[model samples]
Target: MSSAQCNKSAITLKGSSEIVCEYLDFGINSILFQRGIYPPESFKTAENYGLTILMSQDKEIKEFLSVTLSQLKDWLTQKVVNKVALIITNVASLEVMERWDFNIEYDGDQSQGDKQVSDKPLKQIRNEIRDVLKQVASSVAYLPLLDCLCSFDIQIYTKDDVNLPQEWAETEAANIKNAQCVKMRSFSTNIHKVNTMVTYKNED
Candidate 1:
């Protein structure tokens, strides 16, 4: 089958799970870069999803993401994770200034261990990523300027039946005060789908 045709059909569960994690890696890095949470010198440009994307080079940041994304991918493969939020906080006060929420949805009727092909193609998934990346790049037009240093945290929500990892802890939802939320684009594999929304400290 042609590349286009392949992307048009649903991919296996394992295949879709990997793509989801890859998207999270790129998405988080994109947010940090666009929001100026990290210094520009710490990142290098790379190509992904037909766009020039920035990947972090800072050793600490890279290690952190590697560990976090690994856990997220494993949870995703088990279909136990429900939500993943990227929380950006003020460096001084440690207050949550912005949040990038990625919510996952699955067919309730489908049980675990189903490695069925996704109904959506890979090509279509890239298109959705393109739209989101464009918005992230232009976010400075609306998002507040960060005049001070900032840090970020990844918060994951999972089903009650999940067995928590030794390092993972449960915490209250990171709510942004006086939030102004903007719903963004989404894409899916037949087995799993993700919807995105961003909430920022509204300056209103």
Candidate 2:
């Protein structure tokens, strides 16, 4: 995980509509155009080869990924491009806790004066969030993208969980499978300032 504060200027540019034009002119190998607004510098290091775009609102990248799975169904019949790399910006960690309605409770004898706390381990909660996102990214979007492109290698670049739930580390290993598609991993970085480079692989 590469964590750093990004430049504000880059983030502003990324959110602007001009980002599409800017990236097109960037002449990079590939573009993981996260429709969500964030920093632009992160993509500066992408290989100058083929350019691919992924678009969705900043708040809805996960939802968009879920919906895109079915959209790429036809591409499966065409050439096999089995690998894809995902670049996400503005990952809302709190949303996970909100979705799961996770909370802590305390129950103990007041007279005895003992602390009996029951709380979802932060790590466990974070893992649940990671698993959910990973499932959505790999099983839903990346898999479909591979099926459409006719390849199988996929990689992801994302932000490191600050104050994350413990289960996050283990969850990542469970959601990915090696078959028509293999080797899915995620890189972590902070998108609050400058942009970073992410690598994605697909095999058929």
Candidate 3:
């Protein structure tokens, strides 16, 4: 199919679910015209729109877009049509805490001037929260059916000035980055909790 046609189809299929039957000609047209890439005329038919069109289908391009258009191509193959379903789950009601206990040592004038005090640094506190998040993710990663959960949408809710142990927060960030199919959303729950919804689109 021509680049314009493929782009049109892709846009049409955008935001559709796995089981939905829809035409994606609009998406295909948009991608081609927007990117200014033109495909040969030989591929410009309804049946071959998805197969014969190619325009910078590189991994770097896919990551840059953050939407995985190329990967969507594989999923659009004849055999995989309507065979996928995205599952969404919530991990709420989590409580985080920070400890104010630590040891600090300084040597200086005692009676005449200063005294030694013990406290944790802000960096250390952040690291602690990151560690906790890592622990939680580690556990979550090991579930027997986790592989089936291809995409993950993570939402972290907390209170204001809530000093989450640094480690846990960092770990959570890393997990979201490493997930094969995942999206992360963060919110402050003191005012209200937030919810997210996911929907998939298929190309015909």
Please give each candidate's TM-score. 0.90, 0.18, 0.18
Residue 63, model 3: Cα distance from true site in angstroms? 8.4
Stretches of candidate 3 off by over 4 Å are 1-120, 140-142, 154-204
Mark the 10 consecutive residues where model 3 has the least summed lDDT: 95-104
Instruction: At residue 13, give the lDDT of candidate 2.
Output: 15
Best by lDDT: 1
What lDDT would each prediction earn against the true structure?
A: 0.84, 0.25, 0.26
What lDDT score is found at residue 193 in candidate 2?
A: 13
The Cα RMSD of model 1 versus the native structure comes to 3.0
Q: Which 10-residue window of candidate 1 scores lowest in summed lDDT?
A: 107-116
Model 3, 1-204: lDDT tens per residue? Answer: 696654543312122211111112222222332223333331233322223233334444334333433333333321132211212322241211100111111122223221221122324423433333233233334222321212222222223443444433422311111123222231111111111111222111
lDDT (Cα) of model 1: 0.84
Give the CA lDDT, 0 to 100, for residue 114 in model 2. 19
